[model samples]
Target: MDQFDWKQLLNPEFYILLELGGIKIGLYVVLFIVFAETGLLAGFFLPGDSLLFLCGIYSEALMKEFSTGSDFLNVTFLAASISVMGILGNMLGYWFGSKSGTYLYKREDSFFFKKKYLFQSKDFFEKYGGKAVVFARFLPIFRTFAPVIAGIVAMDKKKFMFYNILGSILWSYVMIFAGHYLHKLFLSQFNIDLTHYIEFIVIGIVLVTTIPVLMKLLKKKA
Candidate 1:
């Protein structure tokens, strides 16, 4: 393995993920990130979509760290585990938002907290109603704050949870499975290994996921 590169930390692939080494640690880090990105305000900057996609591509390695099961079992376990974390993370966000109330809106921007993102999430939630929880799961910054917005708006707990569970499962499974199966398909058909070109893959994923959010924000501003 190459010496740990501090510069790689800037890349979402290496951003507080696996830098410490060990597949087991990597799995735990992935769970933590899933939780933090949804649960904590400071987690808004974390890579949610791209990371989940990468998890799919590297599903085998991550799964082996936890279980020696068959391929189906491994992928199932990985997706299920991530889904649970995502649900829990959103729950925490909802809880925090409920407790904090309007204080979050009044809270000035800081390194970790961005007022604009919060407002953006509020607008998304208003537009989508309760469904924002589900739709926001696929979007980056919105996913981080949607749950909080749900709570802030005092959305019904049962409604919030229904969307939360649905969104988390769908998001986690889709991203992970997409990466894993695509990697398998390419390797089997063309003998191409995606892991070798992870940088390009990460950039592509980021752009695909984020560009829409940027355009939406810009359009709203205009």
Candidate 2:
């Protein structure tokens, strides 16, 4: 049998921290990534779904590597940390939106300021109201921009917080846990080595998640 190429097996795009041998650094990196992706405007281009899933897979590997007996506790901590990071990011985004609402309103469409996107976000917010915060969590680009739009429209802070926390908890738990458990499942059932294929799986997951959004755009264009 041939030896597995650990270096070549890992996904270059997804294994940023692991490739660097920075498990400890990965935690902080994941936290910061979550914060930026959720809070900052530039985060619109960051990997959200696939990254969270990969983080879950990485968490599982880290637990095994450290020989941590506290599997449940570790999972809880990972989920909680990501959930908090996402929530805090949304809060920062809301603050920026509130402060910049007028500024953004007067600005014309350009590379960064696409009036259509703002309109789409506004329409989504208006259509869903507070629930948009929760629903947006499942979306890709919309998830990043939803909170900003909420603040731009001056959504009730208390209401936004309620939905924000709930959405963050649900989103973080679903993606991370799914990744973690799915890794366990495949390894156990198929006797497959996850390290060799996890990258491809993550890519497939991203494509799947993006399908609905792409379809929506296609329909609009049609």
Candidate 3:
């Protein structure tokens, strides 16, 4: 069940470059990664809170070197941008789930095709109703599936969009700002290595992203 442990790949330097290298470079990568994490069912475990928080703090750091923007504007842009990414990503994921997922994915099917987790997501949404889309956005595993299941169950598109945008923006701001403030606390309390923290964040994202797969493999072995 052991993976390549790609989580090891992320390091503090990665974040420094990710946020600092250039807007052109860091911007697209962050957008794409965020999309994949939200859209792909396999990506549920990716660190939503931690990732955004880390990016937010690092983005704050970058403001010193580059005219990123006013502090308020920076957070606003990041939150709005993430909102769009999460929503758009869900649209695509839902499309795949609705158009082909029903036939292509069956719960009683083979292990490779089984969407057991999707069923759990369905229950969560049913219990919470439309708000589950927004509510689950904060939870780790459910955050990923709520949208895709919303699509599968034919939750109203307009409703989904409304909640999705609201949730994404709120989630982004909370995490990013939390990261920024936490960084300040660390600095004020004692000298801390920012680079090391960034690297650890990236690695954490990678591990969280891969955890589900590892869990499934472990089940197979059992």
Best by TM-score: 1
Order the candidates by lDDT, highest first.
Answer: 1, 2, 3
Candidate 1 residue lDDT tens string, 54-74: 888877767665675688778
Q: Give per-residue CA lDDT, model 3, range 88-157, as digits (tens).
A: 8777766766666576455464432336666656777898898988877776666767777777788788
Query: In candidate 1, which residue pairs get closer than 3 Å at backbone N, Cα or C atoms, i.e. clash?
Result: none
TM-score of each: 0.92, 0.83, 0.71
Instruction: Report the poorest 10 consecutive residues by lDDT, candidate 2.
Output: 8-17
Candidate 2 yields a Cα-based lDDT of 0.76
Q: What lDDT score is found at residue 150 in candidate 2?
A: 89
Kindly list the per-residue Cα lDDT of model 2 for residues 43-128, writing each as its tens digit: 55567777788777777554454435776677777888889999999999899889897776677876444656666667778888
Runs in model 1 with CA error above 4 Å?
A: 1-7, 15-23
| Clashing residue pairs found in predicted model 2 | none
Instruction: Give me the displacement of residue 162 in model 2, in angstroms.
Output: 0.6
Selected candidate, larger TM-score, 1 vs 3 = 1
Q: How far is candidate 2 from the true structure (C-alpha RMSD, Å)?
A: 4.9
Candidate 2 local lDDT, residue 122: 75
The deviation in Å at residue 29 for candidate 2 is: 0.8
Position 99, candidate 1: lDDT: 91
